[model samples]
Target: MDLLSRGSMVSRHGLVLLLLLLIGCVYADSDDQVFLEINDHKMTTLSNMSNGSGRNEQICTLCEDFASQTLSYLQDHETQTAVISGLHQVCSKLFSLKHQCLTMVDYYVPLFFANVALIQPEEFCQKVNLCEMMASLRLPNRDGPCTICHNLVVEFLTKLKDPDLQLEIIEVLLKACGKVEDHVQECKKLVFHYGPLVMFELEKFLETTDICAAIHVCKASQGAAVAATLLADA
Candidate 1:
């Protein structure tokens, strides 16, 4: 029920994410199938919280508590698809929450770090089962899909020990970095928040120190600019 916005709160952990997946189950009028189809059997809070079914509201409250309490437990162990499905059901309700919901989708999303497969380029897609449907989640009312969500999915796909999948993830994320730069604020925040990981990727995938310095420049500000220049000179 507590929905915090990102622009308002600041903590040592960085921006306080205001994402609350509290929508209960929703019952479609037999014509609605996006839930069953796109969600892949995962029930979101919106689907469960719809007023159409009196049961939806009750399920929403119960699932909300369950998600808040059990998140740590789920993260500790190997979070299977079954568990993710349940969580997705709860999170989907969040889409309809126009006000007072957290915007921290990035935090709660499951991250799967997978390795790349070393096969011929032709066989790569087949070997890894790399389909867009399985690779990314479409954001509500967005133009194209987001690499951020896909990055997490790619991480999950790598669980099969496919190195090709890992390479795909790297390429995907690098492309995402370019997109992030388009929004200066998002790029700076992403770099600062996930600097170590970004640095790791920069070192491995990109074969240059200039790119890292450029990232630092992207993160720098007025006084920070002078320091960046000094670092670049060194």
Candidate 2:
């Protein structure tokens, strides 16, 4: 069978197994029984995969494809629910790490989704050790004032999912804006204007807005247009 066919088969079988496991757990006598049953299921599936040559390569390909597709969907949708659902769907297709995939989805998906704006597929694959040799992608330098402002906004947005760092992040952004010597007022104004909105409706803001442009810090082909416009108006 082709990879697509194989993937679909794996996914269907995995989902069935998942259903079975859930049903079995409901009747099991103890937590240990449930845990052992899950481990046994996972080991059996993994052993089947390991029986063939190029199994490692197949697993790597599935993982890379999953990361790429998940990131693409998250970029387009920009919501936690979209990413979580995509992760679960893709995870079901994997020939190995079935249980770990579910666990990682719960623990790491939030962090990955939070930085979806900044992350690249290859970087994510590498981070999970699924594609070790791929180089990390980097964003270009934001040397212009408005670009700097936009970067700060992106930085703040990327960390919005972390409640523990919310106050510290706000302080950092404010301090960073305070130091922009050339456009100190504009920078701080953008922060003060959008800061509360970010706190209240982060996912909606991400889904529906180009925040930097909304703040007048970035424009198509004219990164410094806002500063120039302010000067011309003054």
Candidate 3:
């Protein structure tokens, strides 16, 4: 199975991806049940590609492919220029990937879905004229939980060995949701009541977070600094 790593070779259309059908994970129960089976799930490829189950391997391979092939499709056809372009600027920075990695559909899919509930990603997909194309996949449907998205993040955290870079990306996602400052105040208010706990929880939630990991650190850092000052003043 092909993987997403700094040194991994990416075929333009992921003919490697084309050979497989990526089945996105579906919740048998609830979000809380997600990690219950973490032990059963195979070690991610980054850690030990040789150790995981066929299913887990498929998830990693497919996800890597999804990130690759989908973006290739979009780029070739000019699917969602605005959203695609915006995500390009963000994902590469967050994941410490080259700008070329923006071609990975799986990389940005969760971030896109992260906004769907609150921001209606459909609007952006429509803007890019990819609504119908995405729906045809019949993967998780509209109301499904973000299981697949979580897996994608783990692929990055596990596959990419730079813990500092991973942590940075995770922080960007948790606080900035794409690492963009568009909603820092909302995040600040949530963290204000339980800053340490929220930070801790965020660490655990790193794998499954829906944050877009888009913005520059300065954007979120400055906004967070201002919020802290306001809280101190109060």
Error (Å) of candidate 2 at residue 18 is 41
Displacement of residue 147 (Cα, Å) in model 3 is 3.1
- Model 3 per-residue lDDT tens digits across residues 1-234: 111221212221121121111101111122533322331232221223333223233333334433443444333323344444444444444343343234344453444443333433333333322323232222343322233333334443343444554444333323322222343343333224333343343333443223222121123444344334432442
Give the clashing pairs for model 2. Answer: none
TM-score of each: 0.18, 0.22, 0.20
What's the candidate order when arranged by decreasing TM-score?
2, 3, 1
What are the runs in model 2 whose C-alpha is more than 4 Å off?
A: 1-164, 205-234
Off by over 4 Å in 3: 1-47, 55-69, 76-145, 162-234
Best-matching candidate per TM-score: 2
Locate the minimum summed-lDDT window of 10 residues in model 3. 18-27
The lDDT of model 2 is 0.43
Please, what are the lDDT tens digits per residue for candidate 1 over residues 2-45?
Answer: 11111111221121111111011112212434323323323232
Candidate 3: residue 48 Cα off by (Å): 3.1
